[model samples]
Target: MRLLKQLGTVAGVALAGNLAVGAAGGGWVASLVLGIATGLLALLAYRWVVRRTERRRPVEVELAGARAGLGAGLLVGTAMFVGVIGAIALLGGYRVEGWGSLTGAAGLLGVAVASGVTEELLFRGVLFRVIEERAGTWVSLGFTAALFGAMHLVNPHASLWGAIAIAVEAGVMLAAAYAATRSLWLPIGLHIGWNFAQSGIFGTEVSGADTAMGLLHGVTSGPVALSGGAFGPEASVVAVLAGAAAAAVFLRLAHQRGRIVARRSRALATATV
Candidate 1:
């Protein structure tokens, strides 16, 4: 279990390192390479810090849980694709263009895996877990959501609305997704699916990447108010509505399954008392 967790942690660091390097006055490929190579270096450095903090010598994590996480991730992908398409269609004049070739498509897979692996490590593995230990599980989830949204501020086409919507819409939901599966698959899936659909299938900028692929290009005349202007669809109000609805659905499902964090909190309280 510890080894598997370490692997996930390392993969995440590598991806993040690559992104950080790619963005550091470095060109695209350079950033990608550097960000990926060293993301886990931070974890390696901090290993000693956490070694004393872990619970009873790591037990074997369940493969069934991990596999289930993959399935959840797929579900998240499908929902985001559907939601983005529905929202964009309502906005109208959605056109598609700039899609790359097969190589580009394959490159997208790399991008997704890198992002999924890295983001989860940062948010779920580190931030969320820390918050959970300090506060309760639900509090940690909320904090992580806020952090997730804040991170978007740095995305290419991010607007204040985009960031806020991400916080409320995506941040909370993905955290919930992570909490649900214990495995990173669900959250990673949601992240990849949401991003891929936004840029790949829809042809709009995912965040502000200015997609090379033009999936469904329609013409929007207004100040990109309807479409997502320079910042891309993520900034649009449509994304907010769609994202909120998705979050709601996720919460509802969690509630039905008795998985809501509040219940966990109450249980813990009872145990303490």
Candidate 2:
């Protein structure tokens, strides 16, 4: 019941926000305003719901050190995407056609912020955290990551390989980030940074979704495996490898911090003893 309530509340806000953003039309100002509003509302809803359901302060979304966490995550996430683009460019998979629209980039920024916040709140803050309490970190991570990837399959250009790539790269990477930091801010920032860089900066499609052209008139061409084709670079093998490497690093940090939870059965047995 608690889980349902938490998920329902946050998910409701996210859905409503997306609807509102869509209703606002394609104007950059409207999208940016609505997106930011929705993101803020979702955060508030999460905090409120957690308080009511768990009867405790929601420290994961706590504002303390939020800026630092978000800033660090944004830097790392942006750098990672840039690195992937760089690699693809070296292989002649991507190129700059010209400068793109700043307005489009701004619109994408709004979308990125809203998505980054709401998704991290839903997956990392609610699903992963709740499941980890009983199933253990490993189980929770795998479950959430798979679900995350599966969700993307509904996208316009989605494919089996694309879904798998999303699961392996973004799903696992974001969850591991939460595991390492025990907060949603880092993952949220990373999510925003990655999305914005893809659509807002590099002017590329994101997760098969057609977005406004970003700061640069970037173009991709070559094999589907390398260029990611219509589904974008996120579907590239490079993205998978980079994301997996990052996940590994975060997992290692989590282990060193003793943040990994034991299986419920093992925990119960230890308690009994």
Local error of candidate 1 at residue 106 (angstroms): 1.3
Give the per-residue lDDT digits (tens) of candidate 1, residues 1-273.
443554455555665666575567554454345533453354342353346456432211234455666566767675766665565666573644434444344444445555665666667766775566546667787778887888889988677777787787678777766565455556766776777666545555666676554344423334455566677766666766776777777666766776555424666756754
The segments of candidate 1 whose C-alpha lies over 4 angstroms from its true place after superposition are 1-12, 15-53, 56-62, 97-100, 214-225, 261-273
The numbered model that scores best in lDDT is 2
lDDT of 2 by residue, 223-242 (tens): 98998999999999999999
Q: What is the C-alpha lDDT of each candidate?
A: 0.60, 0.92
- Give the TM-score (vs. native) of candidate 1: 0.71
TM, every model: 0.71, 0.97
Instruction: Quote the lDDT for 12 in model 2.
Output: 94
